[model samples]
Target: MGTIRKGANGGFSGKAGSVIGASWKSIDYIRGLSKKSNKPATEEQLIQQARFYTIAKFIMPIAPFVQVGFSQINANTMTPTNAALQANIKTAVVGTYPNFVLDYAKVQISQGSLQPGGTVKAEVATGMLMISWTNKAIAIQNGQLDDLVYILLYHPELDEFLTAPEPPTRGLGTVDIELPEHFLGGKGQLWLFFADRKNKRISRTNYLGELDLV
Candidate 1:
């Protein structure tokens, strides 16, 4: 038994004189065929139009929307936490693809001395890490004058952490990022993580930077 009712199964029914079965010799045949009269179309013209409609109805439902976040990480080290040691960017996105909305809220960092005499920067080039901010606010701040800013990198797969030589400065108050050759191919996200000695007090700040590989 057919699932469709008579009129519900719309389309020409192969009628002898209608568009579906009309002959070129008939009065209702297409005038120029290609550039014909609009009164009634020929069977060939009708069939061509029907095919187009069927195809259009079949392919418009599944597409993907993707978003990306940029940061630098080292490709040769892992943090003490197993994930890459991370310099606090405070704004990194995690997971394969993420959906994020910024919420203006207060952030705070407890623990750790914030001496005013040190600096720190985070960078990444390869591997991944977990980033979260559910209850705790973002920790880590900008560098102060005459502080040693340390750059740390992490390699997620091997679970290692490597520290770069400190860049000596009086008040270079900004995170300087560099991608070197050791990273598998010297490409990808480089995570810069760090700790310093100059800032032993709890009030000093460290800064981190973000960059995308070309």
Candidate 2:
């Protein structure tokens, strides 16, 4: 039943038949009721959903990093995080839909013109995870000495992440991050990139591979 205050011709504010009457900012509106579909999903739809879920789960853990890593592509229509999501969907997903796996090597949490180190590696020492690289920004045409390094460790199984709250600059060439107490015996993937905050630029992510957190 619709509620009419003024008279029969007055605007309504409730359900009448198949449409819903409402108001926003004092503007009257009527819209068709939402309909539920009984049709089963097609194979393509199922596969697409699986890919989306797989990628979303992986990206959500380091969304803050993605926001900055993929910032160069942000536009009036798309956000940085969505841009990364769309990108990984095309290149990072592997295997068939039901078995879709994230190809870590191809996954890029951030994208920019800044050049990463020529060689990036990770190692576990004591209770610290040390990430080191060979390239000095001066050695690369696109790199900057002050470009900040985006280093992070991700436990896909736990959906937890560890990042340098204040990143080290390219000039340093290495950063030591203390692992969490629970991560000591666990394993996770390590990723790093270079970003120039002054120029609004970022580098392709470097997958330093998985490591034992010990």
Candidate 3:
């Protein structure tokens, strides 16, 4: 604790003590030593931090890809050769099925893809959910050919999983899976997996974590 001394002019100043004193805007204040506590975060803060951790895990690996894709799109104003790069970045930062027709096009100009993608944005369509990716086949030219893509759909409400064919390919591919009519208004997760065909090794996976069909 510090002491406050009254000046001869009827003002106040801090005396030399354990606390440091200063004046701001004509107000005198004391700065005390900081105390260290072994307090744990509350349950709510822990939950929120967990959510942030999850989001960070999802976006970290793909940040560079998104950044490059966004720059290419901005420079050319043409369709990016790696469209999935932009889509994946957008889905990670924002949600799924973002309105590319609206503010999404302006995302690069305004916010940019600097941060981890936002929450998952669910897409609502009639028949099929189309998942696509590129450059997997090119990896084979570098003697890394054993690459496979796995698409998984999980119905949490029903505790069921709908697995798409795990196809092995060289280059770009698209997987279109027909959803059941009953799942039209349901919620679930759509996960994308890239793995090695030989050891069933997974390189990386993108989780479109929470999907709501309408």
Candidate 4:
């Protein structure tokens, strides 16, 4: 048929695939017609169609809890509202937002290199997985922020890097980051890092927690 016209529901109704059986009556008749009219679809069209299906089915279902990050931050130089995070305050964050996003997903945070006397914590709805250390300041790479800390998420199934542990929306204390709650349950590990902003010294902490999202 001509483009099979978009559905009244404002979606793709294009019958791009082949029909089953055109000779059979009614149900089978439609299938037959589709099969007979099978035309080689473009790669772009297939990709678009696949993306449409993924959005309509998989991604959209998890949209509600997808934006999970920091909800609140309590510190001397930062609050849930500030963006520029200071290096000298103890910040406590809530897991409510992350709870929603990782209801069933597993994630990990990595701390590359950090400074001393700093601390990092990954607070899931269940508990806190933290890392800390004391000593001289460990400098991040030249271009990297002198004292940089955040979360890192790794996907074992995909054997690839998924997302960088970013700050929650609004910055510092409580920022917003998006995550999918549709996770692969079981024992997943997360890494947290804390960097110290100093010279001639090294400071850092490594914390790992099993992500139990059942």
Cα-based lDDT for every prediction: 0.29, 0.83, 0.46, 0.32
- The candidate that wins on TM-score is 2
Candidate 4's residue-wise lDDT over 50-136, tens digit each? Answer: 434422332232222121111122323333122111211112221332121222122212112223233334444432223332223
- Best of the two (1, 4) by lDDT: 4
| 10 residues in a row with least lDDT, candidate 2 | 134-143
Candidate 2 local Cα displacement, residue 78, angstroms: 1.0
Q: Which has the greatest lDDT?
A: 2
Q: Per-candidate RMSD vs. true structure?
A: 23.7, 6.2, 16.9, 18.7
Superposed by TM-score, candidate 1 places the C-alpha of residue 179 at a distance from the truth, in angstroms, of 3.0
Each prediction's TM-score against the native? 0.26, 0.78, 0.38, 0.28
Residues 1-214, model 1: lDDT tens digits: 1122236533223333323423322222222224456688776666544543332221111000000000112212332111211221132322121222211111111113433332233334443221211111123334344444333333334333333344443344444344344434322323221233333323322222222322
Ranking by lDDT: 2, 3, 4, 1
Total backbone collisions, model 2: 1
Model 4 gets an lDDT of 0.32
Decide which is better by lDDT, 1 or 2: 2
Order of all candidates by TM-score, from best down to worst?
A: 2, 3, 4, 1
- Tell me how many clashing residue pairs each candidate has: 39, 1, 11, 25
- In angstroms, the error of model 3 at 116 is 17
What candidate 1 gets wrong by more than 4 Å, as runs, is 1-110, 113-143, 158-160, 167-170, 175-177, 184-199, 202-214
Model 1's C-alpha root-mean-square deviation from the true structure amounts to: 23.7
Model 2 bad stretches (over 4 Å): 1-36, 135-139
| Two-way TM-score contest, 2 vs 3, winner | 2
